[model samples]
Target: MALNFEPELPTFVFERTYTNDHQFLFAFPNEKKMPNARQIQLRRLYDIMNLSVQRNDLPRARRAWSILARCKEINWKAMWRLGITLLGNDARVMESNPRKIDYLRTMLLQLPEERERILAELVQHYILAGKYRDALDELEFYLPSFPYRDNPVLHVYAGLLCIFVAQPPESAGVNEVEETAFDSNSLSRAQIFLEHAKALDPHNIVASEFLHKLHSISQGPASISFASHDSEDETHTKGCQPSQPKRKRSNS
Candidate 1:
């Protein structure tokens, strides 16, 4: 069966962006003149976006997106908010149809100049692409004195993504054959998780709970036993013992 990547028909007016929009309310002198116009417009946009998403109809989505891009209203804020809603909505979609997600990603990035907004979407993109490594790389980037306010959601998503991505393949489904590839700098990761947990909630008990969990891992447990130097050499020799060495592929 073909994928229905587009969002369900959007009742754009009913979406909080238009429903609770003070600007849309105040745009007209008579509040009730456009009583439900917001709802109708919202529904129209939703349907279009939904159709585009489900069908991977980039052309259609891009056309609808173009309208949002040029919006010069005082409350351009709602547009960005709508974009954010897509992030949450499409998280699982990205995981399944990573390439198709590029349609929204390219548009969102182009239209949004705010670092926080861009980073939030970027994090979602990487998560959808199953490129946790890149997502981890982004966390190290600092957004000092950013023009746009920081989003707590980014912190939360980053923490969850880090935990899910950093696990060993055997546990995380990355690769038992490449368990040796898991970086030894996992202590640093533990630190990141705790920090995000803290940022997500300073007084909350869960941050402390996760921090404690990370602390235990960083300290190194007695349960995990490393091989001796002699054993390491023995394993290395066994790896080279194959009758023929496989040729490495070069990406030419």
Candidate 2:
């Protein structure tokens, strides 16, 4: 004879336990993790860019381009589109706010494949901002990467920057001896770069002109006067956007 087991245990006890377990699993999904975070981000980037272009909103475009640039892995086509948008935005930034030059540099570094082309634009931006020293530093950093053996134009810019950095603004009240020493060192450095530029390309008319002017300034008057090195940027394309391909979002 079996004892009355049904009365001892509640029939709904197992049902209650199952409900609690379901709630716990829903609250903390340990077994099933969310997927396609990158794809989702990329989709958002596309949407932002598309809307920005339709609205002709530069600020929005810039924000989206920056986000894409910072992404660790982006498709080649997406990266190219981002670079083009940023290139246009950077030109405006250079004209309005020169201090954002560092941010522009960071954006350029994000797209490694387009580094040379973007770096050339960056150098021009620095020149336009009256930052000769900064421009020279960038030019020197990338000079070795240039396809040519030596960039005579880059050398000319570097030499000009050296002269600018050496020449003290008239306001700094320094003794004649100190001024002479500082100017001498700067002139020596400038001479080295200019000479190298001439050696690289004897027919470089700009280098030749710079050297002639430098010599004239040196001999005619002990007073050092600087010339403007702000060069025009021909790479800037206003109101331009790269065509983006249709990309599918992962549904995983």
In candidate 1, stretches whose alpha carbon ends up further than 4 angstroms from where it belongs are 1-114, 143-166, 171-184, 196-200, 204-206, 219-252
Work out candidate 2's RMSD over C-alphas: 19.0
Per-residue CA lDDT of candidate 2, range 1-252, in tens? 965432122132122222212222112111223324343434445556556755667777776655554544434332443444444544234352344466557756676765655566566666566555556666655655544226676667666666655554545454642355335666677778888889998987666765775786577434534434333321222121222232333344
RMSD of 1: 13.3
Worst 10 residues of 1 by lDDT: 233-242
State the lDDT of candidate 1 residue by residue for 91-138, as single tens digits.
234332454345445655566555466566666555545555555455
What number of backbone clashes does candidate 1 have, counting pairs of residues 3 or more apart or in separate chains?
A: 14
Global lDDT scores for all candidate models = 0.45, 0.53
Task: Give me the candidate number with maximum TM-score.
Answer: 2
